[model samples]
Target: MKRKKTLNMMSEEDFLFTFQHGDYKFVFEYDTPDEFREYLSELKDTVKELEAEKSYKRVQQIFKKEEQIEGEIKKGERPANKENFTFYDLETKFIVGKKKLEKVSASTYKAYEATFTKLKDFFKYERIENLNIEDFERFRDYLSTQVVNKTVNNHMAYVKMFVKWGNDRKLYPENNVQGVENLADSSPEIPHVNYTDKEIRNILEFEEFEQCYKDTFLIATRTGMRVNEICNIKNDDIKQDEETNIYYFDIKKSKTNAGVRQVPIHKDILERVLEIDFPLFPEKTDNASQKAILRQLYRVVKQGEGKFFHTFRGTFMNRCLKNYPRDLPIIQEIVGHEKEDKIKLSVDTYAKGYQLSLKKEILDSVSYY
Candidate 1:
């Protein structure tokens, strides 16, 4: 009797096995040498059975079995059919597991929840595995029609983040949407118009302007703090310098490391802030407060598309640069901006920062009156 070859095999590092059955070929991966040997032995036994039966149908069955085993070993803990895993499932895991683990603030959590809601609406119960780069690009196009370019970028950023998170866990093949670029506005960019000194005075003196909004605007204009930073200010954040006795905002919580610095409260709003018992705009959400401020601002001044609450920060920076052109580092520190110049970088590395009194002087120079 002539000897028959059971199976043709090639093994690499005892981790990968390649098998050829006539013209059909298959590959399998195993975690361990023992696993590879065990799988190979089982496959050999099946081949023997099929060959002895001399059934062509049984020979085709061998290839099917080989593919099934290959997929099973490669997937490991992942489900056999990832098609059932929806985008919503991955989102829920991220919200419940990763977000909770990070202990993000209420406002940040709300923002993430809002973004996830938009993603869910766009994806619409689609399998996460089925999502590809084209789908994300289409979602970006959909967002562009509905919101501004800036907002579309925000939504797309969240989508990329969520998709990458799912991919890390082997929920999908890969982060296929990672290559999707942010949408660029087709319209010409409108330069941000800083609120003029006269406009600043008009807004503050506006009869209909709410006290809280005024307070928030005042802080942003004087200290060059962002809208969210102004809104999140707490009573404890206000501190008095021991030597200078000048009151300043000790901003420990900020969006960036550069933002986490002390800024002097200009004397203009000092008494008003003290009288209000600090945190002048306490418990107000940044978004709602910003919209309310804009509505009141438009009532007093002519509505300019570029003029908004954030313009105050830019206006403040403009004043700082105009008044203290030589003190660029001081102005950068006051505005929580990362030092860009070599001189500023050296100063930042060696010196802690300019004194509170110096910072107060710089802020006092930023007067609209």
Candidate 2:
């Protein structure tokens, strides 16, 4: 037989080479120096083959996962095929919801975002079906430690909304979101009082308000307009009747469809609007209204947390509800409260929108005077 050349490949010269990449480290040694060159060449080729195999497997996994996602979506079903359904997917759903919704305020949207973030962090991205009420309880318990009971309630309500929103679309099964009950009302213990005419005038003339937010605040106090509603107002939203010479703001964005009605501007605020020349509040952000405008207003008036931009809204409603002719439903329409019966459907849908003259009359009933 010819000499066999397949030497059992242990070299005696002890050549050692180290390889390192990221968190992995390795060393290889050859005991035979004369044979090291050929052995090292073979080792390099083997390592390259193993690395190529690993990369191919990874690419295959990515493609397979994408195909699975596409199939689930086409079937109009949640991606339950995956081992872990992502909370990232759920957050995407939340954003879709915010966009589909009409006239959601910036502040409310921020709350939704924050609430979802906390849910994701606490649960660490659980699959929709794998999630249960106990998981919600864990999140709730965690929030209770981190926030006050009132803030906790606000967050929990949005959490329930998230789960309910998903449940409605079959993203989560029914009753999976039920156990997160709201904590008791922990609103600041202050007597609810309507913003008085005296207080309203005091803040309007209070000088500091003059420098930044006099017009918008005056509009809120008079019209009971929410800050978000006013901040988003555009020049086109301000309208006049060629016939009546009446001026009003058509509120296209609000808490409800009832909020889509118009408010005839009072002379005081309208004069200020005329002078400013464009969208009344230059500051567009929600914090500009809440933290910047209202924060200063709150301090100037010595008002507590109980008194806010919304309190002025209550005051407008209080004055109108207490004084305006309730049988006409004028105040209700102006303040954007839903009509209880279909008997008044004409007022809601007639002539481009609610009759401008009628709304003007209702708005005239509400003023800083």
Candidate 3:
């Protein structure tokens, strides 16, 4: 019998060569000139076998991984599954994990949570794969049905914030929802600035809410503070004993960081607050029954006002312009506003009577009479 060629054949010279067919590419190496020839012969046969096995794509993928590892090793980088990455998937992960949401106020997070919930409901299936501008448009339409133009604008703002936040984490492309604009009249309708002190007194003087009403109204009136801000106020926040004495409440939360303040406690309000027995809205024993009772009480107590809670808030700002420093910037500071310039401009536009009063004060002080 003829001697068989060794399968692990070696020779004196070593050489390297590359082989390619269509998109598939590979390297062929041999120890010597004879083995280099042998490798080319074997490579051709291997390609024919791969073609017969219908694995052209598999062969290309193997070559690609090899190339990827080579480049990664040179760069001192670990290989990752690039195939698994996408904009939406990465964004969801970032929003749920890396976005320091705990630092955000509970109320602010509540609003974000509401907007996020709506997104979840709208994009229940394959949210990552299927989200588009039209999806946002659909969300806009849905929100329009639920709220007014101003509120719809707010939802849009929140959504934009969410998208930008997602972008910061390399979650999605920046300005992905760039075309969505704010409402035409973005300076929200200033909440019908007509609710007054007398109206507030009249509502609170009614028997139903009278028990806690005076306490509630006094806090709102004296400080130009928000309703929820007052509601969240703990009994420990009260610090004075006399009706005219000055004290301070550590304002823990508000619309912005500027809202955090040590508000002076008008003692009249402090004394009234000290008298309340429990939470203003105590839990009723029955479920639906309690809500119905409160609704009736709301109607009986706040007849003319469209919203009971907001009526107090409007009253606070209105009183700020009326009795307190009507200087727009001063008013903004008293109310813990971040942007004094905008407040001054808006207050100036709707504050003709106030401006006139200031002019009168100046004229009177000049001793021109």
Using all chains and alpha carbons, the TM-scores for the candidates as numbered come to: 0.68, 0.71, 0.53
Model 3: per-residue Cα lDDT at residue 139 = 78
- Name the 10 consecutive residues with the lowest summed lDDT in model 3: 360-369
Ten contiguous residues minimizing lDDT sum, candidate 1: 1-10
Quote model 1's TM-score: 0.68
- Pick by TM-score: which candidate is best? 2
Q: List, residue by residue over 190-213, the lDDT tens digit for candidate 3.
A: 334445545556655666555555
- Tens digits of per-residue lDDT, candidate 1, 1-369, equal 121221224334455678877655658888656887888998888678667766877878978865765555354345754656666566556665554455455566777888888878988888877878898889888888888998888877888888888788777777878899987866666678888888888877776666777786677778889877777777888889898899988988777778889999898889877766555555656566556666866786666467776787789999998998998788888988888768556666677777888888989988887
**At residue 255, what lDDT does model 1 achieve?**
70
- What is the total number of backbone clashes in candidate 3? 1
Candidate with better TM-score, 2 vs 3:
2
Candidate 2 — which residues are off by over 4 angstroms? 1-83, 185-189, 343-346, 349-354, 367-369
- Model 1, position 41: C-alpha lDDT score: 92
Error of 3 at 333 (Å): 3.6
Query: How high is the lDDT of residue 245 in model 2?
Result: 88
Pairs that clash in candidate 1 = none
Q: What's the residue-level lDDT of 330 in candidate 1?
A: 83
Clashes of each: 0, 7, 1
Global Cα lDDT for candidate 1: 0.76
